[model samples]
Target: MILIANSEAWPGFSKSIECLRRGERAVDALVAGICEVEREAKVRSVGYGGWPNMLGRMEFDAGVMDGATRQVGAVGAVPDTLPVAALAREVMRRLPHVMLTGDGARRFATELGFPIDETLHPDSKRVWWERLQKELSPEALAAFPDIPLAPLSHAITDPERVRDNTVFLGRDSAGDLASVTSTSGWAWKYPGRLGDSPIPGAGYYADSRFGAAACTHTGEMTMRCGTARTIVLALRLGHSLRQAVDLAVEELKDLRDGFIGGVVIHAIDADQTHRVVSLNCEEPIHYWFWQEGMNEPEKRAAERV
Candidate 1:
């Protein structure tokens, strides 16, 4: 049995779970699916050619988890590595440590046959240069004091609003649970700023036997409080996935400063009961659910009870 949930988009993960039911292992299929999406989606947060850093360079971060074995692997602050999900998967297979960062992560990727190149895509390079110009101009700085232009100076200079925080979850028959989370971090972020995306329990989590996987968006706050883990634990306490997420959100709201982001929680009980919860302040919270072998995914929206 497998289940997944996120803030906005669901097709990629829903499709990946369908592939897994056809006899593929959860870890392999999920990672591969996410990698493909990361590359093709080109959403400026995940994958190559999307966004660059304040220094006009592209970097990536990703993580994978195996719930059955309780093993985890992650890479942070990596440069020029496409298919970062694959690298995170490799880290799980090759390294004993749970996390790797910076040059170490890059070295691991190279050892696994990944190419590191200095030539970034033209679009991303141009975005980076424009950010540089913004920083050089004192008028620009004075205009947008709240924008972290200095940090995210390399990519996504435009002031844009992101709606739902997308979360994807998948599980396999063998009860192997795996999750992959990739992001370019915040726009105009500092050169080496790492976000919740690459951090397990913040961006994603899985428990193979218990049948749960979760991922989060709007990282600035969730990363500080282990939001995913909190939701999972709430579910373990016999709360429905929706109940758990609601509680977790309430708790996080109290603890948070002005930070904002969203979370997607997926859980399957031992009885094969499944549920998903998506929470964000931008709009009403949302939910989804499915049982084992079910073909259709159910949907619901949050409203004041």
Candidate 2:
């Protein structure tokens, strides 16, 4: 099994993977572990203290994918819920629909016995109130000479970028894959805004018969370019994983808003040939591996482009 998650709280995610390898169920392990990390770090894009929406409300989104069967379940725009990860799992289990959103998502969560609360976290509330106070003060207007003060201006402008958490677990066999992605969207975004994180084939894609890949950061570019799918298609067309990622990044580079952030990919071939690629503005593409023969994971963080 292999796992890759993006968070400042890496230790917890790493520990969770270890526990899952021990005996815990995969879904349960992932949700519990991630939630625990979120609680501890108070990251403002996941559970509990996540960022609020434009309306000063908090809504979360998450998704899980089963590579074996190519199945996916997702929820968007939910508020004040634990196990937001579980909600994604439930979508994979109960609903025939691939995705749910807004009030509908909230209703479904409640129906499934997930509790809802008007208040999310004290930190989120405090941030919202503090921003409100700042906006209301006459000093704010005087401090900014050109920009005008308004509810929408301060509320929705420049929504905070939330880091997503992703995990991929599967055997070393040539054809086996599994993956998940969870996020809270952008902080202070529009009420119903949705990003690539919960969108199938955009934020993530996996297939045991084909390969697996999950992406994070720059959802807008990923969605427009169909980046995850593009990478997979590139590999299927005979490009190596490294070549595919480089090509994908190159394709997006010339576009107006292309490839603004980073992407992480894990791919394994039928022969158990595996590759991991981490691409970002500041770092050149690199690879890592934990193979059957290797006693520990080997990382090659630097390579000439």
Clashes in candidate 2: how many? 0
Predicted model with the maximum lDDT = 1
The candidate that wins on TM-score is 1
Per residue, candidate 2 scores C-alpha lDDT tens digits across 1-305 of 54444433342455555545665544455555555644543555565656676567777777777666778888887776656657887888998998988788888889989877543676776776666555556775455433443455335433344544444433423234555666666666667777776777777776666666666556767777776677667777887777777776776565664336655554544344555555553545433334444445444553322
TM-score of 1: 0.79
Write down the TM-score of every candidate: 0.79, 0.76
The RMSD of every model to the true structure, in order and in angstroms, is 4.7, 5.1
Off by over 4 Å in 2: 8-12, 19-41, 117-119, 135-175, 257-305
Model 1 misplaced regions, further than 4 Å: 3-15, 117-119, 138-159, 162-167, 256-258, 261-280, 283-305
